[model samples]
Target: MMQRTISTTKHWIVIVLMSVLGCGLLIQGGYMQAKAHFAQFLIERAFEQTLVDNQPHKPWSWADTHPVAKMRVLQQQTDGFQPLGSDLYVLAGASGRNLAFGPGLMLGGAGLGEQGNTIIAGHRDSHFMRLQYVKLGDIIELYSTEGERVLYQITATEVVHETDMKVLAPTAEKHLTLITCYPFDQLSGNAEYRYIVEAKPIDAQPLYS
Candidate 1:
């Protein structure tokens, strides 16, 4: 009888432990989701302030990066280029942490809307997911903090190995190079290939209200 009672107690203990672990995981997931949503809100507000002041603004007080530009993808319509997605704030550094929040500008690249190649990188599954649907000749608009808007026409899209650095080399004319991991629908992480979207500056103008 004692042995049977001990076995029953052991089963109950295991069930209780598993229940605690499951709840802990649930709470952790909820916290992460909340943080992600809140972070985007802060980033958007900071980007707006940066545009107004023409200065860099951290999305959060402890953030190591700041908003440098805003980006929007557009599709050609009968009425002209229509927005395909909401504006995304491009962060200054292309670090893993910064990419988690939004696209990141590759350091040492051309300044936004300036000469040379302005490169930006983002996660394939997140901010740059729309790139997969972007066709050649689609429009990409980049807005600098100073309110200058540069329009780029998509020229090409290609897949390259992660080690292929030639796509990121400097260019003589103004260009935009967007990089994300390929293939877009992969179920696993740490993809070894990269998807490149190449664009050339076609127009520039001051953003108006």
Candidate 2:
């Protein structure tokens, strides 16, 4: 009888441990989802303010990050053109926390809408997830803080080692480079490769005018 009681106790202990682990996983997932939604909300507000004031705008009062640019993927057709998805706000720096919120414009690169290479980095599972669907010849529009909208056409997409620096090289012509982790579906802790998208300016005129 005592052996049976001990066996029953062991079973209950196992059940309790599993229950705690399962609850932990659920809470973690929910927190992450909430964080992503909140970040996007902040970004949207910043983007709107930037457009209204024609100046850089911070998403929140205490945030060190500010919206530097707005990006949209354009879908062109014989009859008309439309944006593929909602606008994504580009943040000032690509720190891990910043990327969790939005795409980050690399410092020391060409200023937005300028005549040099501009590099931006975003997380694969979040802000840059749609980049996988971007194809050659697809048009990308960048709205800068100065209220200038520039059009660019995708020229190339490639995968390179994470340490490759050539992809960020400076150029005399206007260019936009997007960097994200490769194998978009992978959930690994260490991302060894990067997916890069290069676009060249096709129009110099401001989009709004």
Candidate 3:
């Protein structure tokens, strides 16, 4: 009789442990999904505000980052490569915390529409996933907070070690640089490589409204 009671207690303890683990996983998954959705909403609001006011706008009261520009890739074929889509919100500052919310502009780099290089970075799983499809000669439209829209033609794409700092170097002419982690479909662990896209301004006039 004592053996039976001990066995039953052990079984119940195992069941309780499993239940707790399941609940923890469920909560984590739910929170991640919710965060992704909320980040998109925040980006959209910030983009709209920048367009309407022609000034930097924060998505939320507590946000340390603000919308600095809006970017879209042209759908036309460029060197036999066509991008999937052309809509992205550019946020100020590219810290890990800022990137969790959306694509961020590197703070020390030149501002959008400036004469030097402007570097932007986004998460591989979310904001920059579409970058994998971008190809040479594809046009990228960047709208700045000053109500100026500049067009950039993609000139190059490369994979480099994460420690390569040359990718972020300032240019003598206007340029746009995008950075994201490599191996977009990785299931686990941080990637050691980075995927980079480089573009040069093509038009002097603001083409996008």
Candidate 4:
């Protein structure tokens, strides 16, 4: 009789342990869901601000004109973007609620329209949650302090290790490279691999009031 009672006690213990583990997992999943949702909201807000806050440029193309004409070229200068000076961009990746955390704007360069590549990074989990759905040839539009809009076309999307910042380096030609945590497999913290989206300037359209 005693042995049977002990067996029953052990069974109850196992059941309790299982229940605890299950509940822990449930709580963790909910936390992650909430975080991703918040990240999505942040990205949307940032994108909108970027569009509204870009600077304006006076349109004057000086080619093969005289030096006097160059001085005559006084175009209207528009407001430009104020750089965060950090590579921590709010991602707008996942189409749904995933933030798709990746990199934001970093140092050593100006905004989108100058020379070289302007690389941005965000988290695969939080900011870049939706990057998985991005296809080749998609458009990435950013506004600058000059009130000008910079256009980019996704030229390549790749997966690399965290050590591979080489692809994210500035190029001789203008481009925009987005870096984010890869796989999005982890429920929390940073990922091992990186997801990179490389884009180039395609076309531009003037924004008029």
Tens digits of per-residue lDDT for model 4, 1-209:
99999999999999999999999998887787576555434544444444555422211232111010000001122543222122222322222222232234544533457789776665565445556766675656665533455677678899999887687565888987777777876645656788888888877442322
For residues 93-148, write the lDDT of model 2, one tens digit per residue: 88888887888999878888888899999888767878888888778898887678
Greater lDDT among 1 and 4 belongs to 1
Instruction: Pick out the ten consecutive residues of candidate 4 with the lowest summed lDDT.
Output: 65-74
Task: Give the 10-residue window scoring lowest on summed lDDT in candidate 2.
Answer: 200-209
lDDT of each: 0.85, 0.84, 0.81, 0.54
Model 1 segments more than 4 A misplaced = 1-37, 204-209
Q: How well does each candidate superpose onto the true structure, as a TM-score?
A: 0.80, 0.81, 0.77, 0.58
- Tens digits of per-residue lDDT, candidate 3, 1-209, equal 99999999999999999999999977885686568558767877877877787776778888888878777876454244344554677888999988887789998899988889999998887778888887787777877776677888889999999889999898998999999999887724579999999999885433332
lDDT of 1 by residue, 20-67 (tens): 999997787567546655766788899899878877788888999988
* Candidate 4 deviant stretches above 4 angstroms: 1-103, 108-110, 145-147, 188-190, 204-209
- Predictions: Cα RMSD each: 4.9, 3.8, 4.8, 14.0
**Which TM-score value belongs to model 4?**
0.58
Q: Candidate 3 overall Cα lDDT vs. reference?
A: 0.81
Model 2 RMSD in angstroms: 3.8
Pick the lDDT winner: 1
In model 1, residue pairs whose N, Cα or C atoms come closer than 3 Å (at least 3 residues apart or on different chains), thus clashing, are none
> What is the full ranking by TM-score, best candidate first?
2, 1, 3, 4
